[model samples]
Target: MAERVAGILLAAGSGSRLGQPKALVELGGETLAQRGVALLQDGGADPVILVTGAVPVTIPEALAVHNPDWSTGMGSSLATGLHALAETDAEAAVVALADQPLVGAEAVRRLIAAYAGGASVAVAAYDGKPRNPVLIARGHWPAVIELATGDTGARAFLRARPGLVTQVECGDTGSPDDVDTAEDLARVRGVATVRSEEKS
Candidate 1:
């Protein structure tokens, strides 16, 4: 049997810049947190975990884990998420951002495919630039936790080992835009609404 990979959604940001918690932000008639969980599950991640910091969220489909050090930065949330995955049988984790609603399941599947093909670190790339929904093998979680601090998350660790990463192009799958401000929210909501309507 193939090894399992968990999906970790970082939703702990206070969203102070956006005037509300990004997790609760609505898009396409669903909260960002809800949408994130669905995307991860649909993309083949087993036992999806959501790391919330600024405020507690209750999403029935996901195992919600709180990061008490959320105020410190994204690194804390990443650590908390990894810690939550420690007890699971997951061989790796696919990290996704709660605010990035446009990042679709196809990107995640691609990252998983890379990991299954022997890549220890897989990252979604937009136009050749590294983006969100990165896949981190279990072997690197400890080091990632050590380097993850403030808003850096796993960036510093990933940067230190560039040769190990497998970048998968996902420009055709979806956008990596995140809603960090009211203007950004409005823009993303508009886009989401249009897409939802088209699907309906």
Candidate 2:
């Protein structure tokens, strides 16, 4: 199968809860944005687009393009990213958030695999709850674009179009844990420390 999927990383949030730029926050020696990009790269997605707005003036050169309207909401960023994908010949796209460091390369692989297996949309069902890091087939892109508004993302739209989605299970607890607050960051650090200790 030829590569037909693209990766879209939404990184333009105000970070009001985090009190700083969450995308630039360091995690496991890499920024959240970098980690998100790496996941897409590792998953074999071509031409990943990183959308930024709230604080995206200095996005790294590695990201194909950064949307400055990120402050409007995830929906605007999603619309922008999806539109960018439309320009490409991609059959689908894997949409993710920069704050989700736990959505590592393995998770992305599973998402793409599920979508490739015929799911019009493949979303991560972490802890039995569907969230970001979803794979949207070309046929479902319009719905995704239509349902996005304000800060709202594709969850509601995905829910409305239940017939097209196939949920995939992810093994990591962090896969669902987005770093939105100071406590969330602390928790992530703690988990990383524990994992490091176990490895040693």
Candidate 3:
């Protein structure tokens, strides 16, 4: 059967460092959560899932799943998303971060393309450096969940099984800069302004 790649947006974080929830952060007119859903959908992922925690977020065309244990960190949200996707017919999932508004849909498409090209685990790479928008086949969901502790997400599992992962180059496609601190958000929002202007 062909792989059906879904999307998981980790928006559960309260963004304590940024003084609010990252998911609700506005960038160029849209909330991070809204942009996230569009990013995945535009990249061809169907039934994108947004894992919510610190605050409730409702994104259009996205399935919001509350993670009660979100206070633990991104790992739980990552596990929660995979567990939710397990109930669906999707054979794989492309995990993206809500705070990473700079990452484009092209990255997601490339990850899905990698999965279709025989990669069970793929991470979008920027200038040869592995980053977010990681794709993991359903077969490895259990391992990812088990190793996804703290804020590391699936880093432990990926590091432990390096041979099983594939890095898809996506540097030219978009940036992986995350909106973590106030300065970070301001910087990205400035870039966002430039991007919007260019489109006009």
Candidate 4:
């Protein structure tokens, strides 16, 4: 049997620059939080989880875990998601950002594949640069949680332990572009439109 890998979406950002909570932001008629869950689910993750902060979000598709210290940043949300999963038997978890809606499910699949291939840590890379949808094995959760302080999320731990991360090439899969501002969102939406038209 395949190991159970949980999917975690970090949607706690207030998106002060984007003018609203990123999780609540809309793209193609779906909230970022909702779309993020579907991305994980479609990527073959079981029991997808969305970490909510800065705003109240209730998505039927995901188990929303509230981070009371969300104001501190992504680190708290990452810790929150890991703690929530510690209760379960999942061997690993795929962490993603809500603002990066353009990241494809294929990235998640590749990270999971890396994890299955004996890599305890996997990061999706676009155009040779490591990006979102990182995969971490359960054994490394404690170290990750300890380093996950402030807005850095897993970055601190990942940087401290570069040898553990397996960069999965996913540039062909999708973009890790962030919707941090209105202009960025517009650009991402435009890219999405082009991709959709291409698919059709």
Candidate 4 lDDT score at position 142: 99
| Residue-level error in angstroms, candidate 3, position 131 | 0.4
Give a tens-digit lDDT track for model 4, residues 52-151: 9898899888898999999998999999999999998899999999999999999988888888899999999988899898999999999999999998
- Model 2, 1-200: lDDT tens digits are 56588889888887899998887898878788888888888877877888877665344534545666666788888998998889889998889888878766777788888877778789888777788688988877888899998877887788788887788877673456779999999998777667768779
What's the true lDDT of residue 47 in model 2?
Answer: 73
Overall local distance difference test of candidate 2 = 0.80
lDDT, residue 174, candidate 3? 88
lDDT of 3 by residue, 1-200 (tens): 66689999999999999999999999988999999999999998987999999999987699999999999989999999999999999999999999999999999999999999999999999999999899999999999999999899989989999999999999998899999999999999999999989989
Candidate 4 lDDT at 60 equals: 86
Question: What's the C-alpha lDDT at position 147 in model 2?
Answer: 91
lDDT of 1 by residue, 1-200 (tens): 99999999999998999999999988877999999999999999988999998889989999999999999999999999999999999999999999999998999999999999999999999999998999999999999999999999989999999999999999998899989999999998888878878889
C-alpha lDDT of all candidate models, in order: 0.94, 0.80, 0.94, 0.93
Candidate 4 backbone collisions, by pair: none
Give TM-scores for every candidate, taking all chains together and pairing residue i with residue i: 0.98, 0.90, 0.98, 0.98
| Residue 74 accuracy (lDDT) in model 4 | 92
- Model 3 whole-model lDDT (C-alpha atoms): 0.94
Clashes of each: 1, 0, 0, 0
Give lDDT: candidate 4, residue 109. Answer: 89
